[model samples]
Target: RLQRDQELTGVDVVVLDECHERHLDADTTAAFLWDVRQALRPELRLVAASATTDAEGWSRLLGGAPVVEAPGVSYPV
Candidate 1:
């Protein structure tokens, strides 16, 4: 949406799921979001949701943003 519209205006947040895979598209999206947040919208909230994402790496990428890890709970099916 950012590239197509040139800007993501009025949006509150963007949540990226399955970021632990670290695919090209995910990385690109993260980079774009980062750039947009830096240059355009400082208030835009970006959340990288994943089971195995490198919190430290992503936090650093996001200008030392805080990384909050949720407690993992599982139940057998």
Candidate 2:
């Protein structure tokens, strides 16, 4: 949707999952979202989620955003 230059309309948040993978498409999407947030929608909320991602690195890349860590979950095998 972003690459196609389509408007996000009523969407207020975007979640980028598996950011630790560092795939090209995901990177591009992240860049686009960052651009949109900076240039178009300053209020648009963006989230990058991964179990093992570099929280500080991503926070720096996202303009010094704060990092939130969640407790891991495990089930009996």
Top model number, TM-score: 2
Compared with the true structure, all predictions reach lDDT values of 0.83, 0.86
Residue-level lDDT tens digits of model 2 in 14-59: 9999899987888888988998988888888888899999999999
Model 1 gets an lDDT of 0.83
Q: Candidate 1 lDDT, tens digit per residue, 12-44?
A: 889988878867988888889888888888888
Residue pairs whose backbone atoms clash in candidate 2:
none
Q: Which portions of model 1 miss their true places by more than 4 Å? A: 75-77
Clash number for model 2? 0
Which RMSD does model 1 reach against the true structure?
A: 1.7
- Give the winner by lDDT: 2
Q: Between which residue pairs do clashes occur in model 1? A: none
